[model samples]
Target: MGRGPPVIDFSPFYGQDKAARSKLEDEIRNACLDYGFFQLRNHGIPENIQKEILRQSEDFFNLPDGVKDKYNKDVGEFNRGYERLRSQNFEKLTKGDLKEGYFLAQDLPLDDPYVQARKWAQGPNKYPSEVKDPHLWKKTVDEYHFVVSKVAKNVLSVLFDTLGGGHEFLDDFCDHPIAVLRLLHYPPQEPDASELERGIGAHTDFGAVTILLQDSTGGLQVRDRRTGDWVDVEPISDAVVVNTGNLMMCWTNDRYVSNLHRVVNKTGTERYSVPFFFDGNPDFLVKCLPSCIEKGEVAKHAPLTVSEWMKGRYADTFGGSQEKTAKEMVEV
Candidate 1:
């Protein structure tokens, strides 16, 4: 299909007529079932805050290599902290994922319950202490994280109703989620590039939902399931792109799809993006929604907790399941 993904406005949720709410729900359902993605606007994040977040990201990524490297340790098995470019390899690329990133999570302490449980990826954020402005970058990110989370919870509410569940479907897990906010920087590419060169590999997100913010220099592409072709997810001014993830597909019993996507940067300018992943509480049980299972259809997955599924997926990506590989690498 040559069509672009749908644009969904969530105004109805802010006390509108019942008819408007119904129409929005229908759009949400159709977008999820067919496109696996949608663009959102009027989601309540301030414009100034978005711009400041991007500015801080650019400032941090522009820091000298030596200064940045001091915090580049692969803590918790590469889950958070500074990761250099080309450190991660994708099977589809001759080069590795060509973007460097700083991974962050809700700032927690060593004695936090999740950390005490030995849950990997749960820790305090890695801040650049030597930077000229104290907490400038950290401030922007922390504020943006709080802002986007509100947007995600609102989206989740719509998703809950779309699956024929009530408002309480996601209420239990939204307040204390296991989410991560990643800031990515893709350098400019040569004017003439080969097919093998890629900014990021084709893969599906491992969590439940992703909300992304990027500059106008667009390079994101989504794989079309019906035609088996790639579609450009162009950057629309002031719009945040949202997509479902693998665990969400499982929860919906395959009613929704988690699309395959990749990124490439050929615009001869640095590209930056921020993607916030919304994960459920570690112990939240993710089971198929009753409405998703028809009379003859059966649930596709057994009852599984969010942390268990996420950990298993990480293991699969890191080749930790194979007997030989498992011995060589520590589990994420």
Candidate 2:
């Protein structure tokens, strides 16, 4: 097994051995402080589920353009559906993304009458039934969502311990956090012209953390904070790439930086990546911890719920158009 800097086997941490857990916790802390992103191997997410997701995603994308358009997210502000190429703005805050994507959120209770009424915030996901093999696509995507959710929660446990808190600290807050998994498809382009374009532009995630599963094409790059150069993030088989987000940066009082990254269309080969984002429950209160804050140092941020903080960042990062403030969402 090829081990990168600060990459420790997480399996030992889950054991009852206090000594092993402590050692791993120290490693985890170093990972957070230094890289802000790490590659995880032997992470326990089942292989079948991962393969199935990729297989189905390929099938879904192969569908006719008209059928894929049936699930376009741009039809509404909720954007809980498919996004064709150029649907999202990712380059220079002005240009649109050159890639296509499928956006899926945690499933909610459909029977709730208010669910349908809140058209913008939460609405039913538009499953692409128009595809040739609708059943296969729907089933695979659903299975992928459940499996990734499990892996994400497990990662949260390590973060909880590393942050000097118990798993309950995160569990109590993330009953069903505003988590999302985005499946992206960036096809190979003309060599000369594509170098200037991008699959997804440079931007920092707006949530607490993101777990990414990328193919071996190696188009992902992270900005080296000290050198101002883009470092290629190579993909290893069966490994997940994890990174801290804006909320985590705030909670850590900027001790852990949310490094900027972008996807370059380097190889003349198609690339597919799945990035799972975990934003703690909206109502979960977030405040600077004693370890992160000093006696004389003023707290940079006031107490705010995870949801409120996330909603604001989402609006800025993803361009949520809702006029309501975080306070207004809480009232509803």
Candidate 3:
């Protein structure tokens, strides 16, 4: 009958730590092992900044469909720009998600090496020029991305400390990492809707870690790893909810659970939440954690590079269609 997730403060673990750091590390380690989700507070992100980012998001989402469509995923190749409602088949459109989103990737220059390589979903953001407060929206989102990415790295450091490992294991993969910032808006739903009328279907995140900034209108839920039940992820003010993902599970050698979660936005009011997905370098090799595996036991999964595994997962979920630029057809 519990109502919410653990609210852990990051201040105790911030730079130049002391006794409080060790205690917090133990707490985070246990929380990761058992819950795999927790809201982090005192992570040094100012309240006004978070609110402004939400405001900017609301403005952009409320824009006319014609305007938003200008930056749709068809244009950005599913890596950046707006994703129309129900376009993503999280549960094969069985009462599919009643939400729309704006996805932002690492804003790389056109001359960047990755851009030249024509990689998937790796490039600058496609913003709707007609948005109200375009400057503020871009600034807010970009700033939030920078701050949140740093916080996620700090969280990883805590995880490494918990695992009794050095930064060498994950540090290289993070430098100029492939990060995704998603802003989602869920419309109001009929109170009589069924359980299958989900705002987002049951699923686990794909990357290393997800840092979520949820608004007051709450609907997020986590599946209990032990019981066959769902627990409400009640939104706490000034705290970002963080969760491990499939990649983390792989890296941890199944030591931690990347529990499945779904969003059922039954509330009659609108809901807004943004999640920052920090992924690894595409080329990083993923294998069993030496600590997680016993002295002689074999690793459950064979070695796979991050990029290869991601491509496989995508091919399995979304077909193996060749991706072209959003402007491909329009190009002369």
Candidate 4:
């Protein structure tokens, strides 16, 4: 077993003590720079809400295939509904991932402007009708999304401060953000499964940041930057694992890391985890932060809106063609 990611107590950041907040900021900065991953404890989300969401997720996934298939995501849909097992292959070198998932974003009505315009990942979610208690399921999911979204925003504010940016630097960027909450289920691997088969293949996330709530049955692993070896990210009770993603790496001009991670469920029991991806506003331009660039260093990546980057990545993963009009809209 390799070393676990750092466990960070997030409650101090919310306090009024300047010295304590400063120390916590330094710890977060080091975690982002060195590991790109850390376990966040005492985040404001309630434990009961977390448990309820997981329970609802398990109940939904436990439904028969025919029943669950009613909500299957369309080929071109980026974030909307259910995805069947082996639906994605994050690492092309390996077989399709062995996990199934359901995707939901900021719920919008049919009359919402973004939904009417068919903006990337902007639409109402598809909820299953076959759950044991449909109303409770919807309520739990909505409540979790609402609470976790605030935590994600707070985490981003702290990260920006550490980068020498203003507290409100991300205010506009997070307005109507293209955030996604994914409920993932990984079944036990087959006895004779090849090494090439995995629950989720090695890949880095495409968003700015991800907050993951993992269960007791642990299988998530992160690749160590220094040794090129995979390290286990053990599950800690009531702690959500937070990691920087590719967009953050680009925005910081590589000052912060976006380390690779994957899951392999060797344990004989089913595994479920929920990850909230805060990808930022669709129209917000992601350019390298001025503070992150050294005196004479040039930015590594050109500026691109969150929509452009996310759409391209979704197209690559799902093998869907990009819409010409949407591409042009981002260019303008």
TM-scores, each model vs. reference: 0.91, 0.87, 0.91, 0.94
Clashing pairs in 3: none
User: How many residue pairs clash in each candidate at the backbone level?
Assistant: 0, 1, 0, 0
**209-307, model 1: which lDDT tens digit per residue?**
999998888999888878878888899777899999877777788788788888888788899999899987877878888878889998887777777
Model 3 misplacement above 4 A: 1-3, 76-78, 93-95, 315-332
For candidate 4, the per-residue lDDT at 146 reads 92
Between candidates 1 and 4, the TM-score winner: 4
lDDT string for model 3 (155-224, tens) is 9888878877566867787855778898999998788776578788777777689999999999999876
Model 2: per-residue Cα lDDT over 1-332, one tens digit each: 12233455777755798888787778778878876777877777777777777777777777777878888877865557777876666454535666888888766666644355542234456677766677887777777777777777787778767877455576765665667778888887667764558778787777778888887788888876667677788887778888887677767777776777888776888898888888766667777666777778866666677766666655643555744344311110
Clashing pairs in 1: none
Q: Best candidate per TM-score, number?
A: 4
- What are the lDDT scores of the predictions, listed in order? 0.79, 0.71, 0.78, 0.86
Model 2, runs deviating above 4 Å: 1-6, 76-78, 112-123, 317-332
TM-score of the candidate numbered 1? 0.91
| CA lDDT for candidate 3 | 0.78
RMSD (CA, Å), candidate 1 to true, equals: 3.8
CA displacement after TM-score superposition, residue 207 of candidate 3 (Å):
0.9
Candidate 4, residue 243: how far the Cα is off, in Å: 0.4
Locate the minimum summed-lDDT window of 10 residues in model 4.
Answer: 323-332
